[model samples]
Target chain A: MKSILIAMLVAMTLPFGLATPACAGSGDVVVENAWSRASIGTSRPGAAYMDIRNAGDEDVTLTGLRTDLAGMPEFHLTSTNNQGVSSMSPVGEIAIAPGETVALAPGGMHAMLMQLRRPMEEGGTFPLTLLFSDGGEVTVEVPIRGIAARGPDD
Target chain B: MRRRSVLGYGAAAFGVIGMTLFAGWWRVDGPGAPQAVGARPLPLTEMEFSLTNHEDRTVGPETLIGSPTIAFFGFTYCPDVCPTTLADISDWLDALEGDAEKLNVVFITVDPERDTVEAMAEYVDYFHPAIRGWTGTERQIARAVEGFRATYEKVPTESGGYTMNHTASVFLFDAQGRFVSTIDYHEPREFAVPKIRRAMNDEEAEGA
Candidate 1:
């Protein structure tokens, strides 16, 4: 019986030791509905939005992001005064609590992509890497929708 | 007792500042100068101004007044707001059925520096063929915005280029060139469609 218990413990610990970084597919931190709009005549600058959810028991901080789609990928926020004047600014870091969802939406929080290598053509797809402060890196495929799409669901 | 007096003065000062900020906010939101909805007609001043259209022809209130006009002030470079609003307008017009013909939709560019007539033409064409676009010199654009009582300012970015900070509301005008109502930016289609129908119907009533 003592040997059997030891074997069971070894089996439980083996999965953890061999586990890989949560790649947004393992569901530790999941990114859903990642989407950006199509470019018009010029590629210029573009914006993307998505929902980042933390399903694990521990909190996670989004420390970095990368994409070949743009020269610069920045987390940004759009703020409007009561007078309807709108402004955009870069956000330093975004933290997601355990079991909570953070939405990056238009007219609010978004990912600003600058100096695109090519136009984000409609119906195209691109890859994004989201790095967590806990050293977990997730690669997600983002879809390119219409120029006036409100979101991926649209 | 001295500490209590200081606290009292601080509270009073804070209240004064709060009220001033609230007033400013109200002014910007209530562009037509706050009036009870559906109770009284807006005392709209004459909607008169001249700007070059996409075709490089001069147009003004005289040309747009014959039909109900839906005008939005935005730039072509706007990634989200402008295109989203234009799409919403297109959908609203579609929901209008045949009544869409009685309405003329216009987009006036606030960033006159980059939004030339040629650019405006291409931009509007991508949205809807019926939607005309307008752009002009800085002075002309400024005068047009002033006439509409709208506001816009240029904000410089780190890259040395600039973005426009402007009113996001869509202004509705009756066929007689009277101010009807302002549609809040990104208002749901159900809410906006009705307001537009009412604006168009009101024109028919006046004409009859």
Candidate 2:
């Protein structure tokens, strides 16, 4: 299946501890397993999840996110309080250290795509540009899975 | 002397009534209430809701009288818990196979202002065919929330938009409209499916 291929691709892209660090300050942030769910409608926002691995030797802070799929993309966290009530709120940038992987997965941290340009249909892909504080931008193709999909593997 | 005897009888009568009420509470909302991490007791008494389904049909408490029901409160814009829970519900139904049809799954929207009938139709349709979406006016939604003893509020986000905070547990009811149990958010299928079946197998088994 397509998701399996994506999983394989993510596994292959993982750090193997080979190759020298790039000095030009690009490709330092490797994103893997980037996937999103099919939106209910164009008006309602969609969520994109992925794992960000910092391959560089320096600490990099993810400043912002951008995509044509939505008017604005913000880092949102969905948290459940002790009262069994759930709330989603916007969060700040994420920082990744060298050789560290930060996951923006379901039921936790995610990129909330707001005011979609169009519906994110299943079997589709969108380009998401992750802006880093180091003036580097990494764009990854996010595959669209089913509405109820748990993750890229699912 | 007469006052002392009258007082004794009054205390004994109150004690009997208290035990009766507690026994009823213990039967309905006692055990299952604690199993859920943050669950509130599904109202001690019967709760009801009258709303319009995604199919544009009016569904009320009476309409679900003969079947076991699962009612969940959430919104369409909720990307995390709502979708995750709905997916679990879909999987639970799949696990149930034939028995799934015996259950009535209803997803009621807390944010009716944005969740229109058309919106709910598409939302629930994406999860499962049997899952029904319901939406009503603000007043109607408030009544439903109050009746079910659930809570929800619209919180303003930094983007000048609003998101909803709502009860995340799924409520199960017997065919007689009595509260049976609650399934927490992200509850494993091993536990959730049995709760659904338990509700389904209660008094007046479905498909009779």
Candidate 3:
């Protein structure tokens, strides 16, 4: 009887451990080097960056992002005028190829955290949720980094 | 007996309430009422020079001498920094309420090739009617920028085009053309606005 009870307990815990597979639809989408910029106290906006790798066999499109620290979240791209000027524009979608990765960094494509509710202190972490086009969401903890920190592509 | 008693009570209550309200209202509307007004004032700086306005007119720097000036530098082709900074400035100016008139905002373009006097006028107009755009010959603008130690340089790209890498500080100058301070392009309003107001008030106190 003792051995049977132990076996039943193990069986019950096994499903609990494996239950995570249901929420992570296409397996784990790894978010590496995720970071957000420190907010300036004024009408200042900050940018967040990271590398997204879709190790699964299916392509993934990043549809949206949400953060409590910002009034709104947007994906953006920074372009330099070959004529000697640099500018940034809004990027609508970022597609991640199967078994490939997309990077967001400074002076390139990045996530804009607008209307910051508080200043991002260095070494601090904040919660952000990234929604994939296929209705899957991944929550990440982003580290606050200095302005000089280079992104993956940089 | 009951009717007479009720009528007497009603008349007594009405007279007492009316008298109390009349006294309170009279006191509030009387000449001795308290008045609240803003006591803090921004300071003014003055400077004089003959520079060209975006209208191609030779307007002296003296035109900016009477009011506080917010100045920024960038070229016309700049995709992000210039417009973002200018838009922020416009928002800041709009928030100033009655304090807006005491300010003279200037957008000075570093790319003289594209930002002509007419072009600057049109561009600055897009942000705020109160903002003035200033552009001049390369040599003239170079001299002006030199006076403030602001710097910019051009680098060639693979497409045979060039990009300008320039300083991104927005300078606050007093009416006298003296550099009061510098605000980082992305600094929050909590820091920027209060500092600007302080600078203005300091100038006023000194003038007084």
Q: Supply DockQ values for each candidate.
A: 0.24, 0.45, 0.03
**1 against 2, candidate with superior lDDT:** 2
lDDT of 1 by residue, A1-154 (tens): 4533653454345345433555332236667668888886444578888878776666778876798988777787777666555667778878898778888877777877777778888999888888777677777788988876766865
Per-residue accuracy of model 2 over B112-163 as CA lDDT, tens digit each: 9999999898788888788999999898888887777678999997678888
Top lDDT model: 2
Q: Which candidate model has the greater DockQ, 1 or 3?
A: 1
DockQ score for candidate 1: 0.24
Instruction: Please list all clashing residue pairs in model 1, or write none if there are none.
Output: none
DockQ of 2: 0.45
DockQ of the two-chain complex in candidate 3: 0.03
Each model's lDDT: 0.76, 0.82, 0.65
Q: How close is chain B to the truth by TM-score, in each candidate?
A: 0.78, 0.77, 0.72
When sorted by DockQ, best at the front, the candidate numbers are 2, 1, 3
The alpha-carbon lDDT assigned to residue A102 of candidate 1 equals 86
- The candidate scoring highest on DockQ is 2
- How many residue pairs clash (N, CA or C atoms closer than 3 angstroms) in each of the candidate models, in the order given? 0, 0, 22
True contacts kept of 3: 0.05
Off by over 4 Å in 2: A1-26, B1-45, B204-208
